[model samples]
Target: MRKTIALLAAAVMATPAAAQPTPGVRMPPEIGAAYGRLGKAMMAHDAAGVRSVWAEDFVVNSPNNEVLGREQVIAVMEQDFLDYKGFRKHITYVGQKPEVTVIMGYDTMVPIKGPGAGKQVMRPFTDVWAKRSQGWQLIARQATIAEAR
Candidate 1:
C-alpha cells in the first residue's frame, strides 16, 4: 500500500499543473473543434478556411494596437505578416452563455515573418465566439504579446 501510494503521488507531482483544466470551466467539444480548425487555417494561410471560422463582422484588437476587421486580418495573412511556423493555444478560462462563449488563453508561436521573426513568442489572447446560423464563429479577439525570445 505504501509503495502504491508513493508511486501515485510521484505521478501526480510530475504532471504539469497548468495542464489541468480550470475548475468549473468546461468547453463544449464543438467549440474546441472549431478552434482546432481555426489554427489549421491560420497556419495554412487559407483565406476561405479562415473566413469559415470568423464571423463577417469579426474584429481583433491586435498587439500592434490597431483594431482590425476580418478583411484586414486576411490581408495580413496573405502578406505573410502573421506567418508562423509553430503555434499552440493554451486555454485557461472558458465562459459559455446562451448567446456567446468567451475563452482566454495564451498562444505560443514561432513567427516566420514581420517583427520577432524566427523567434518564439507568447501572446495572451481572448476570443469571443457566437453560434451563428452556420456554426460557431469567432466574433472578436484581443491578442497581446507577453514575451518573446
Candidate 2:
C-alpha cells in the first residue's frame, strides 16, 4: 500500500511536466526542450506549435501593446512569419534565475516576398521565460529593430 501510494504521488507530481505548457521563467530540461521545439516551430511556420511554448498569459511587445491570448498570439506570430520570408533568428541563452530566464538574440527577416528581394534587417530580441506549472514558457518578449552596420 505504501509503495503504491508513493508511486501515485510521484506520477501526479510529474504529470504537469509531461503535459503542461512550458514554464514561464525557469528553463529546466523539459522547459528547454519546449523552447527549442518552439524555435523550430517558428522556423517551420507552425503557429499552434510555436504558441505552445508560451504561457496562457503571454505578452509580446514589439513597440506595440499587442497583449494577446494564446490564439491571438499564434495568429499574429503566424502572420509575421508568413509575411517575412527570410526569417532567421540566432538565440543566445543569457542567464536563468529562479522563475525567469533571459535570452538575447538577433533576428534577420526579409520584408519582401521573393527570395533576396527585400533588405535583410537584423533586430535584437530579448525574451523572458517564466517557470510555470508546465515548463519553461515565455512570459514576455520584446525586440528592437536595428540596421546591420
Candidate 3:
C-alpha cells in the first residue's frame, strides 16, 4: 500500500500544472467576462446585443425540449419583446470547474406600478457558453421549469 501511494504521488507530480485539470476544463477569466456581457444584454432585452454574443451557428435546447438554431432563437426573443415589459435575471453558473457547462439563472419580471406594482414572475433558465476562436459565444441555452426537473 505504501509503495502504491508513492508511485501515485510521483505520477501526479510528473504532470504539468496547466494539464493538471482535465483537457479544455480550464476556466479562464475571459469566459466569465463574456458571460457577464450576455447577462447584461439579456437583462436589457437588447435582442441585437444578445445575438451579437451568440455564435453564428448557435443552437439552443429549450425547456420545451425543442432544438432551435440562431435565427429561431432570435425570433423567440423578438416575440418576447411583445410579451415581457421589463425583467431581471439572476445567473449562477452550474457546477465547479468550467469546461463546457450549463449556466443556470432565474428570470424575473416585476410590475413597476399600478394595482400589482412590484409583483414579480420568475422563470428558471440554463445556458451553455463556449469559448471559440472569436471568444466566448453563447452556443446553447434553455429555460427550465423547476418542479418539472
Candidate 4:
C-alpha cells in the first residue's frame, strides 16, 4: 500500500540518525508531555492544539466512522467538543513495542444541554505513536463509546 510504503520510507530515513531511540523502548517524559498537552487541548476545545500533536497523515477511527488526515481529525475533534460540554481523558497504559508505542486511555464527556445533556459518556481510546525525525508522531488512533457506570 502507498501509505505503508510512505511509512516505511519515513522509518528508513530516520534510521541513520545519531540519536535513534531504541525500538520497543519506553520513554516517560516524552509520552507524558504528549498526553498532558492532549488533555489540555481536549478540556479547552482547542482543536489546533490537539492536532499539533498528531502527524500530518494521522488517521483515527471512532465509533461512528473513520477520520482520515490531520485536518479531518481536527474537524472531528471540534465537533466532539461542540457536542459534549466537558470531556476528560484518562490514560490507562503506555506500552512500548519494537517500533512504536501504544497508549490506552479512556475519555468521559458530560453533555451540557440538548437531548444528551446531563449524561456522562465514556469512550475507550488507543493510540499508536511512532518515533519520527520530528519526534513522537501519533499515526493511528481508535476509540469506542461506552456507557458510564
Candidate 5:
C-alpha cells in the first residue's frame, strides 16, 4: 500500500515530455544491463526470470489510466510475449541512484504475421526499478501509445 501511494504520487507529478532523454544519450550500465537480462527472459518465455525483475510491491499506472498491481502486470507481461511476434525496448534515459533507477524509453511490438502485422503499437514507457538484495526489481511503470516521430 505504501508503494502504491508513492507510485500514484509519482504518476501525478511526472511530466514525461519535459523529461524525455536526449536522443543518442545512453542509459546507465546498471539499468541497460538489468533490462537486457529481463529482455532475454521475456523472449525465452521464462516466467520466473521475468518475475525476478519485479518488486514485491510493484505497481503500474497504465495508459488507460487504470492502476495495476504486481501479479496483474506480470500476467500481462507473460501474455504480451506469448501473443506478439516480438516486443522490445529501446531505453533513452536511466536516472540512477545507489539503490534506485528510473528508466524511460520506447517499446515496439512486431505482431505475428496476419491482419495484425504492423497494425498495433505501444510505446513511450517509464519504469522505476529499485535494486534490492536480490537485484533490480521493477517498482513502477507507465506506458502509452506510440507517437509518430
Candidate 6:
C-alpha cells in the first residue's frame, strides 16, 4: 500500500504545470467571445470590426511606447501597418468587477508588416474593458514586446 501511494504521488508531481488547469481563474464567456472577435478582426485587418469592439474613448500605451487613441490605432490597421499573419492571446490573469474587467496576458503573433515583420513576437498586454448598454468594449490597453524571434 505504501509503495503504491508513493508511486501515485510521484506520477502526479511529475506532470507538467501547463497540463494542469489554473485554479480560481474563471474567464467569463462574454469576454472570451469578445477576444475571439478582436483576434479575428486583427488577423483580417478589418478596421471597422476592430472599431466596434473598442470604446469611443479607448486608448492604449503601445509597445512603441506611445500613448495612442482609438482612431490612431484604427488608422494603423486601416493602412495595413498592423497586419498579422498569425495571432494568439494567452490570458494569465483576470480581475473582474461589476461593471469592468481587467485582463492581462501575452500575445504571440507573426506580423506581416511593421518592425517585427516575418518574426514571431510575444508581447505582454493588459486590457481594461467596460460593460456598456451596447456590450463590453475595450477602454484601455498597455502592451510591450517581451520577445521576438
TM-score of each: 0.80, 0.61, 0.54, 0.65, 0.67, 0.79
- Put down candidate 3 lDDT per residue, 1-149, tens digits, no spaces: 33322212111110011112233444445655665565555445566766667888777555445566777655544443212235444544444344465556555554332222345545566666676777667676665433311
State in Å the error of residue 59, model 5: 1.3
Alpha-carbon deviation at 44 in model 1, angstroms: 1.7
Index of the highest-TM-score prediction: 1
Alpha-carbon lDDT of model 4: 0.55
| TM-score of structure candidate 6 | 0.79
lDDT of 2 at 114: 24
How many residue pairs collide in each prediction? 0, 16, 0, 2, 0, 0
**Candidate 1 colliding pairs:** none
Instruction: List runs of model 4 lying over 4 Å from the truth.
Output: 1-27, 43-48, 77-86, 113-115
Candidate 4: Cα lDDT at 57: 78
> Which 10 consecutive positions of candidate 2 have the poorest summed lDDT?
8-17
Worst 10 residues of 5 by lDDT: 9-18
Worst ten in a row by lDDT for model 3: 10-19
Put down candidate 1 lDDT per residue, 56-139, tens digits, no spaces: 998887654567688867765665454555566677898898879998877676766455667787777788899999989899
Model 6 residue 28 lDDT score: 74
Runs in model 6 deviating more than 4 A are 1-24
Instruction: Please report, in order, the local distance difference test score of every candidate based on alpha carbons.
Output: 0.66, 0.53, 0.48, 0.55, 0.58, 0.63
Query: What shift in Å separates residue 102 of candidate 1 from its native position after superposition?
Result: 0.5
TM-score of model 1 (CA atoms): 0.80
Compose the digit string of candidate 5's lDDT tens values, residues 22-133: 6776666555566666656655666686677667787888645778777665565454423443455566876788888887777655444322345555467888988888
Q: What tens-digit string does per-residue lDDT give for candidate 6 at 26-114?
A: 77777777776766675577777777788899887754456767777666555545555456666778899989999877666675645
lDDT of 2 by residue, 1-149 (tens): 33322212111110111222223433357555765677566556676776677777876553333343556556544554234455565555457788887876666665443223376766666777888877788877766556632
- Cα displacement (angstroms), candidate 2, residue 134, comes to 1.2
Best model per lDDT: 1
User: What lDDT is reached at residue 111 by model 5?
Assistant: 43
